[model samples]
Target: MQNLLSNLKITINEKLYVKDPETSELGRKILKNSIILIDEIGFESFTFKKLGEKIQSNESSIYRYFENKHKLLIYLSSWYWSWIEYNLVFATHNISDSLNKLCISIKIITQNIIDDKNTPHIDESILNRIIISDFSKTLLTKDVDTENKEGFFLVYKRVINRLIDMITEVNPKYPYAKSLASSIVQGALHQHYLKDHFKTITNLSDKDCLSDFYIHMIKKILS
Candidate 1:
């Protein structure tokens, strides 16, 4: 499975970066280590200079790939959503039951990420950590409208649209499939954050219960 995953290539929006990071080794290192640094120190404190020092490359080299840290953040987010959409399809493609597929989808979204050996450069566990903590920052910026116009959010939209299709499959007449799909994806991540930092506010007291709660919530709503 890891080997198969290694072969997976996600096409991120060209507008997200100045150069294609996947095409060069230094670019890949920038991505691999940036995820680690951001996960360790948080995005607000992360900088291209810090990333350059970590990767042993000049700060200018980092800029050759991404214009700024925010672009890199969006790039990582896009890559992550693309991977999630891939796994979602892989996990649900053979299932005939819409509800079963939805459950599997929820499981994929809510479950803890395991580091895959096939993609040695990408530590998915760290990437997921970044997603939970920093994903909204990608859109919650003044340039978001400009970025959106450039198709920077396509990968994210693809993830939501895929889930929306599944929700529609389960309940064609459901009035808010898109809303529910967005809620499940973003809410699951938010719950994970709440469980970690504000345990008293969330019913998800532990990681193991996250999948069950979301699965149950989605099922109850769809039923």
Candidate 2:
């Protein structure tokens, strides 16, 4: 899988950036350090100027890649989902059994993320923390409707749609595949958040147990 992903380039929406951050060394530095800096400080307090300081570049140079912090957050979210979609596709492509495929897909989406040594520019483990903690800011905004129209959330939706298809295949008669699929993805994030912050309300105290809980619930619901 590492070899397969060695050459992978996760595409982000062009509209989310003023320039392609993957195309230059300085651009890549912006991306690499931005993820680290954002992980160090929550997104609400993150700014291009701070990111620029971390990268030792002029603040205006950061704007050359992103229009603002909001767009950068959306770019990061899009990139994260695209990476997940890649893993989901590669992991499940060879499995013929629908339920088994769905189970693996669930594990892929809901399981804890670790850094992939194959992608050096981005620390997926840290990025996963950002997704779990701050991904909502990318969507729960006043511009979400307009951004949705612009397809800013396309990769994220595609991830859910893949699960939707898998769910339908597992149980063709299941009528709520869309809702269930969306819930599984969103719920996984929420559960992880609760496990980290509001532990009293969630039984998913263990990282591995989180996946098991969802797999169990999904089986019961689809069966």
Candidate 3:
């Protein structure tokens, strides 16, 4: 991890020393502490008071970055999606084949979901946070104050758009390229969760029966 940080031009100092302003430093500290707290204490158990004690900051300082636990959770959920976008885009950029790009994109996303170390509730938390954004309730409650209520959903929409760009060609035979790509992504993700969450009945892990199913769905859509 230290080597990776160094490679990214991040110094491996035991601590951050921006010396810019207390709020700036506190923001980083709070985020780091929140991540650790979420991992160790579970996000549901995480509290601003506890975070302040862990990071040696007051709750007021913590509120500067995130007004509440839900807002912080929103950040965490969106961060994962942003990370998925970064990794998938990077991994598929060198591949010249459109079909390969689509395959690679879905595979990377599935692998990410399966490989994440967070607890199952983290995924649930993501959906809850997205729901607030979906209905603009986060802004309605005066907790999060983004000018555009749909900012987070826009990120998801952009990901779907990128999938289209990667999957569809300049002169494609498929009449419904974008919609097909959306369906393929939706099927792969939904099937993965359905199988995992209902493992008792389905006896399927994310990709245990999913890869073949997804490929068939893709073929049917493309055909």
Q: Top lDDT: which candidate number?
A: 2
Residue-wise lDDT of candidate 2 within 108-169, one digit each (tens)?
99888999888888899999999999999988989899999999999999999999999999
Over the stretch 1-223, how does candidate 1's per-residue lDDT look in tens digits? Answer: 4455668988989887899999999988998999999998999999999998999999999989999888899999998888888888887878999999988988998888988776778899999999998999998989889889899988888888888999999989899999999998999889889978999888787446888987887788888
Report the candidate with higher lDDT, 1 versus 3.
1
On TM-score, the stronger of 1 and 3 is 1
Candidate 3, residues 77-192, lDDT tens digits: the string is 45555555665766776788777777777775544243233322234344422332232332345534452353644454566788777656633666676786667555555554
Q: lDDT (0-100) at residue 123 of candidate 2? A: 92
What's the ranking of the predictions by TM-score, best on top?
Answer: 2, 1, 3
Clashing pairs in 2: none
For candidate 1, the 10 contiguous residues with the lowest summed lDDT are 1-10
lDDT of 3: 0.54
Query: How high is the lDDT of residue 9 in model 3?
Result: 20
Minimal lDDT window, size 10, model 2: 203-212
